[model samples]
Target: MEPTSSAPGQLQSVTRALSVLGCFRNGEDLGVSEIARRLDLPVSTTHRLLAALVEAGFLDKVDVSSRYRLGTALAEYGQIAYRQHRIHLAEPHLEELAAITGAKASVATRHGNDAVLLGTSSWREADGHELQGLRLPLHASALGKVLLAWAQAGEGELARLPYDSGTARSISGPAELGAELARTRERGYAFNDEELVSGFRTIGVPIGDEPGQVRFALGLRGPVELMIDERVPFFVDLAKVTARKIADVLR
Candidate 1:
């Protein structure tokens, strides 16, 4: 169907083009027919919109599968938005976490089923690692567990998210996850025993409201030996202290 005209002299093509772009929000690669069906438009209109998006570098045509996916433009815009929104809200605490622990500090948010790194404070002289826009397992990593524990703190939040045991130390399932999260609540910390990476342990604390809709985390990552042996308990205390201090600012 021809897109309904909104105003005199306004090309309806622009409106249809936007609809086609919106189809990628489901995080799936879309074929021409799928895009057309989703937008309730004719194939010809969908093809035209897709061609425009590809030409303008807003979408890309995958030759192997003949599918269309979001292009570099969206990634660039997303990075800009992450820095402007989440990172700006998180930076001050990140700096303090890094300073107090003398370890790398990072904050992350749930992006789809994965954890997206929002920001980090790393003093190069302090042997810290880079942490901008990295993705990690939802069931692993101090960063991921902090968010999970935050979710688990709520009455029914755990049911909303699915779990997988792809990692050697992932929670195995949601029931186990709920149990672990309960422990985190009581202990005021979470642990990643090489759950995300082999032989690398991290201690993390979730930062957010009671329901644990954790949009940010205060994480200290290091070698598993140091992370678990003499350092885990010490880091746990530091994380709790760090979390309370950051919460003060967040309020």
Candidate 2:
């Protein structure tokens, strides 16, 4: 969903149209009515927005299903953005880390109140192929905590965290999260002990040169049984080494 209020001169139609595009997910098609229900707009208004997007190559209609999917234009733009981020340079290192850890490894950055996966390598069942571009709640993910902790997010951003989006193990509010972040900073890493998904654990390490200058983070995820306390130091050390490799490539 999109925010209702826009800047003084912003066009409502443009905002609505962008929101319609955001409704789509990886490998999924959605009909106009479903999109309308998600955005809580009238079907006619949603239809008009969808039509405009289709005309602009941001969406395509499947003739058989009468559903819309993200179009080639988005894929083109996504690829352009991906290249600009230089994430490809770190892909091999991520793959190496995954192989060594027998888990999933990824690079992520903060986007609003979420952590957006930029590149990922998974050698086990814990992480799926669809992880790239996936958005995880800032309060519920190890990558997110690393970003928030090392970047020193402003008060405004901290206040807007979607605490309810995470599981029971997630930090309850800003105060609690602030304490967790302090500990994460002191320990040189962050952890997600079933905060996002039960039976899963993840460790995140900063990818930048120092605390305040961190622009990205590296994450390692596996089942809790595989990520138990006894093996955490090994995983964290490997993750930090992988993070340094990624930071070198990013620089």
RMSD of each: 6.9, 4.4
Q: Which stretches of candidate 1 lie over 4 Å from their true place?
A: 1-76, 83-86, 99-102, 123-133, 153-166, 212-214, 248-251
How would you encode candidate 1's per-residue C-alpha lDDT over 56-129 as one tens digit per residue? 88899999999999999888888899756646666776777677666677767777667776667755444435
Where in model 2 is the C-alpha error above 4 Å? Answer: 1-10, 128-133, 154-156
- My TM-score estimates for the predictions, one after another, are 0.62, 0.91
Model 1 poorest ten-residue lDDT run: 124-133
TM-score quality measure for candidate 2:
0.91
- Which digits, one per residue and each the tens of the lDDT, describe model 2 over residues 176-210? 88889889999999999989887788999999757
* Global Cα lDDT for candidate 1: 0.72
TM-score of 1: 0.62
Clashing pairs in 1: 150-212
Native-to-model Cα distance after best TM-score fit, residue 138 in candidate 2, in Å = 0.7
Clashes of 2: 0
What C-alpha lDDT, on a 0 to 100 scale, does residue 93 get in candidate 2? Answer: 97
